[model samples]
Target: MATDQELELIHDPAYVNAVRLAGKGKLPKEKAGNFGIGTEDTPIFPGMHEASALLVGGTLQAVDYVMTGKSQHALNLGGGLHHGFRGKASGFCIYNDSSVAIKYLQEKYHARVLYVDTDAHHGDGVQWSFYDDPEVCTLSIHETGRYLFPGTGNINERGQGKGYGYSFNIPVDAFTEDDSWLESYTTAFTEIVEFFKPDVILTQNGADSHYFDPLTHLSATMRIYREIPRLAHKLAHQYCEGRWVAVGGGGYDIWRVVPRAWSMLWMEMSSNPTPTGPLSPEWLDTWQPDSPVTLPQSWDDPEGIYEPIPRRPEITEKNTLTVEKLLYPIRSNQSSSVKPT
Candidate 1:
């Protein structure tokens, strides 16, 4: 479901060659700067293609597993390179793997797909790729591009003509807390899935947006991130007859954050809820063994999904009114008006 060999599919010949050149282990003066080939974030190390390919290959296999009905849902934690464009790469992604997978699904299985991204960063590459596409509905939630990298997923950037309104962007703020965030995401996703009703769901679950992530300032706990996979699974079962493909986008804290968040994701997909806050020994052995962070016996209990709906009606109304007032100008009925009864 994701890939780096998409040179023929999405990349310019020149840019693909540039990536290839960078892989050769030498660099021109601007090579490191322009290609992001050698930087603190995306160091152009040897086997760049291989490491990226592992992600892609794993994702593609997941797609097959889901398509074949072996599993109702599948996820690729290392996938979701949304920053890579058709002719160029940016934002730490060399190849737009999510787009590549979407195209593949269209071509091979003729599957109608809905791609939703909740990364702190906009899914610019994926959105732009499918801008004029009617078959794909792209929805994203993130800090408004004005404050983030690759700034593009504004509210009005809907798909064109037949694709109009099929695309939606809900940009929150850098400091937006969890309760408000998940409420918006759940509302939008529920509405969109009910309307478009695609054959499959492809979600970009990026842990980079979490509070612990070094890259983005957005605040999301492990529980919110964990809820995403669970929600994706539930939605797939509800709307798509249990067909789902998940791709990882931006989780940079390679040692501390990314693996734990993603492990919870895997647990969600597998329908096993491990006690939160402590990494299970089973998980630790898989992700780390030698390092000091050899995955804990159990993951620390996350704050847990925010209390979007208060237990009491009066309190729920109060929260709803607050959202209705603050978010009305921006989302209007799309969010605030849809308060749960």
Candidate 2:
């Protein structure tokens, strides 16, 4: 498990102590709010610190395995608590595992890092942590904060000072279907990697953009999940020499959406054949009784799973423009630098 010092790499020391005390029911009630505890989103509970620290430890271990060449890629499904900040917790995330892991990558391995976040919610904590540092580049694609929580991640919130052009956000509109969602993701990720080639790539796979997830309004499907990892895997090999570390982020539909989405990630990372057709009857039978919603029987979502989006064309066009604007600087620089020899 991660020690107190490791968490302090990205969290305030006092806040770490507060989480420890609150986990034991020893922190004063009035002071808990100061550290973002005892709220509807992140309630105090027994072993909260231990639980959060363990997730950080898992991501750290994944980083070690990939950076040290023990493995080319690793996944920590419990480790993408991207909303946790230095002194405060939000959105049910504590300890900010991805932030700690990125800091660890820089300090321990001396590697340039590229952080890619695809959660429905903004990866606010991770983005803010390295907002001023150029060595760590963060790219987040999520639903537009105009209608979502932690309403930041606008197209213009690039980095500051030397970190300018290092931070990228593509906040797609609501009701965006699979084609439009993938278009934005593929375009931004492709260009960003070309712009900022790094020694390692860290991906936060939130899986909450799926239509089944109740927390967000994006209309993606299993298709994006399968393709997300495929591209990440290909890019890791192409640019980072196969060093990639993946961690879980926000996915509220635990029974249906998350499992299938994350399974595709693992399959792509490990080079396993993508599973198609029906899901195992034995597996479905085991969990179907407990699930309030009927579990999907196939790997891919069926046709017409939801009503056709009436404004799909508009949403797609808007997202396309957003991606173009976000990448204009990089594209401009690239084009301007190319001169006839």
Candidate 2 lDDT over residue span 1-341, tens digit each: 99988999999999999999999999998999998899999999999999999999999999999999999999999989999999998989989999999999999999999999999999999999999999999999999999898899998999999998899999999988899989888998999999999999999999999998999998999999999999999999999999999999999999989999999999999989878899999989999999999999999999988888999889999999999999999999999889567
lDDT of 2: 0.94
Which residue pairs clash in candidate 2? none
Q: Where does the lowest 10-residue lDDT sum fall in candidate 2? A: 332-341
RMSD of 2: 0.7
What are the lDDT scores of the predictions, listed in order?
Answer: 0.73, 0.94
Residue range 240-274, candidate 1, lDDT tens digits: 88999988888876766677778788888888983
Evaluated at residue 244, the lDDT of candidate 1 is 92
**Model 2, residue 255: what's the lDDT?**
92
